[model samples]
Target: MKKRAIQILLALSLIFYKSTWFWRVFNHLAKPYLPASREFFQILLLMESGVLFLAVIY
Candidate 1:
């Protein structure tokens, strides 16, 4: 049950990370602090997705 719940949350987070509106707001907030905010966000998303995928598999 616990693992299943974690898998569900990871799936939800994967979906959330793919949303444009969420990134728009994230970039808007992070742009001032980071010069290459979009690139950083993309890398972060990729890493997050990888971790989530591995978690779901294991």
Candidate 2:
């Protein structure tokens, strides 16, 4: 359990780091083809972060 939590924590930090530049570029490239997916992507990140939070907190 502790190992899993540590993994999630690391993933959360990686996501936080890449989200700014990497996600922006990726989203911009995909925007023309799938405008609505942007919201989905944001929600996906939100959920992932939430799960990671729970894993790290407890």
Please list the C-alpha lDDT of all candidates, in the order they appear.
Answer: 0.75, 0.78
lDDT of 2 by residue, 1-58 (tens): 8888677778778769866776889777997798878888888878877876776766
Tell me how candidate 1 scores on lDDT.
Answer: 0.75
Q: Candidate 2, residue 50: CA error in Å? A: 0.4
Against the true structure, whose TM-score is highest?
Answer: 2
Instruction: Judging by lDDT against the true structure, name the best candidate.
Output: 2
* Tens-digit per-residue lDDT, 1-58, candidate 1: 9988878787867667675666888878887888676787788877877776776767
Score candidate 2 by TM-score against the native.
0.59
Clashing pairs in 2: none
Segments in model 2 whose C-alpha atoms lie over 4 Å from true places: 1-15
